[model samples]
Target: MFKSFNIRKKIYYLSDTIKRKNVSNHLKEINFILNNPESNKSKIIQKSNLNNILNHATNTTPFYKKFRNFDSILDFPVIKKLVIQDNFNEFQSYPHKDKNNFKVSTSGSTGVPFFLFQDEVKRNRNKADVLHFLKRSNYEVGHRLFYLGVRLNQKFSLKSLIQNVSLIDISKLTDKAIEDFLEKVAKDKNSNKILLGHVSAFETILKYLDRKNKDITNIKLNSIITNSEHLSVETKTKLENYFNTPALSRYSSEEAGIIAHQTIDSPDTFVVNHASYYIEVLNLNNNTPVKPGEIGRIVLTDLFNYAMPLIRYDTGDIAKTKVCDNGSIQFESVEGRKMDLVYDTQGNVLSSYVFNKIIYKHYKKIKQYQFIQQDKKEYEIKLNLQEDKFPFEKELISEVKEDFGKDANVNITYVNEIPPLASGKRRKVINNYNKNNSLINPALSKHESIT
Candidate 1:
């Protein structure tokens, strides 16, 4: 039966199964920890693993050698993206055995691209962790997955061609593009399909479908998983309404594989993958654990990445934490990356999510967008577009004027590309108003005149 389907996909699935089995022991240990949340044995195992990784990093990795005398984990310095970027080579444990390691690059969304290597074992473990979480959504090994995210520029190998996966580049999303992708998915009647992609990408597709009045009721999906950005209630509800399936959100990064996943029982709350990662919610002012319910910076310690162990790695996102009745820790809500709110003429603070939804809703030709708040009432909109001109620019401006009032000054500029931050992360909205404000204000109306 498998042979009748795509042979390359079948072969890839079989090979993936074998690789997953290779890390069966690690999976079993993780499962054990998940099952026995109250058991001291899990903590003992976790501590042992952390100690082993730390010992290895201290002895072999040049970056961590200075911390050999660190008696407590807290005493160890919290490393940021720049630290890794500056000392790339020092992070590797066995640089001479490059054959045993695979190179992985960060998305550079923060404007700093980080290149790191992972041993084959750590890579397999990451895959295993992903598989375990997928099972929560009733996803099986043979299920067909439609991934909508960043498109890799590399040529697809025979293995990739055979895999039960379809890719749609999120950067090129438009009304016609989304319609064609959905039409293709609608053809596969018997396959159990799963939709996975960045949250914003999913929102873009949903908006396009809504505008075109496309019906997706006949195209049944097992689940919809969103990642890469903060998943808003509005977005999740929209997805669930359109697809008629549970829309789950996942918190993960290129640097650290699966961090947390929304469970079937609670689609809104994220349960941490405590076995693979030790998560900490620290005070933004001082790097110490914040009390439960207080929003703080999310720091993570990867238990399995021996090639480049990330201890107390600040993830640059903020979230409140809670201890459930089962003694498990969960994220109450993710506030997204720390960004200043854009202000209107009346001093009304507008969330970045609000602008994101509005821009994508009004303009179908926009491939990418960024909003820079020049002042309280002045703003600049930078766009990377799929077409030469935005047909709905007038309507979009009207809508913005309605929300922001007529006193607002808006400038729209089309660009070939919007650069990511030094940390390799792209911010949708940037607030420069407060940063530019000084004690002695300029007497010239305190605002730049817009032509």
Candidate 2:
């Protein structure tokens, strides 16, 4: 029932896909040049192309031109959520087209759910990257499986009908749908195929699968391709151990199709997609280039996207840069969203994912809690209790101290409720640390105040 698109449509889809795949391969060569000091001529070509593209966009697009005078990428001025939200039209390099292409909005997990348009070139690049990463894990493209969040809405949309004929719904990850999903996964032969979805949804599904004593590891499936969320080492291990397939992490965003990716040579690290775009790891505060092995914010310049030029755009992700022995740029880790890092009293930089585990471990007595760190030695843990749970609180403090340190002075404040943000996501932690400095604030203390 599920067949490929008709000849004309399939041709349309494939041509763009080929362009993007070609772009991705080109990027690899460019990255090879950038990583090697001896490939000086390649660097010159890349730099020249970048400058020309930036100049063209600046002269042609009103909003994009503002960054031209900026001496350093850091000086380009950060694009806050409000700026992008309000000035989307100015961000577009090409004139808005009719609905010949696709448009989707960001989920706004970071308080910015703005709509972005994707032409065939952008869409195909994305698909190619996913397919390429999957192939690395020995997965073939013809494998049968269910895909989450890939929809072509138009009712009785041609694409929808095609999916209905071929794809089975194991159910989406929701309170109402999860039980059915587990049952379907267990019974369906397609479960032995690749299960592709967002990392968070996949993780939640794995938990339920593990609890039911269903040995998914026995399933003859390829590896999992997880994107659009922070995939931690712990999460990766849990998924691989449970599913018995490698979990390949993909680094991408809407602005740029495929910025970086993991492959056989660098499984733990995301190599920059040097063919289609250029990547820079610079100090978030000052925008200066960070040395290898140093953590910094990620900035990218899309070389091929003349539609909406993203040149030296601050992507709001914190990561460490590494140069492999083979001389390639490796994105060691994506440390949550750029503004999402939490600091402890001892100035330890902790990712929110790290704390999520601690919270889930103590999920029994804790109704809800918000973590706020004011200074190097002070922290406030505000929580809503199902019962008094005072004993658990003391134990939590002790555990946190052990996990963090004795130097950390933590306060457990019991509250009625911890409010969800406007975007409908629960922001369980907030750190009012200095954005100007890459380091955590040593002077932060409890009295620093909470709004």
Candidate achieving the largest lDDT: 1
lDDT of each: 0.73, 0.61
lDDT by residue (tens digit), candidate 1, 1-451 = 4433355445655676776646556667777876666689988987887787777778878878977976757656666788887887787777435566778887565446677777777787787788778878767655777887676444655544454666777666767788788888888654677888877677678767766788888888989998777777877888899989999988887778888889677688887888888788876556667898887778888877888887778776677888889888888877665434466778665555667667756455776688888887887888888677777777777777777768888889889987644332357777777457631121222111111
**Regions of model 1 farther than 4 Å from truth:** 1-21, 94-99, 152-163, 339-371, 375-426, 433-451
Best candidate, TM-score: 1
Compared with the true structure, model 2 gives a TM-score of: 0.72
204, model 1: CA deviation in Å? 2.3
Q: TM-scores of the models, in the given order?
A: 0.78, 0.72
Superposed Cα deviation of residue 359, candidate 1 (Å): 8.2
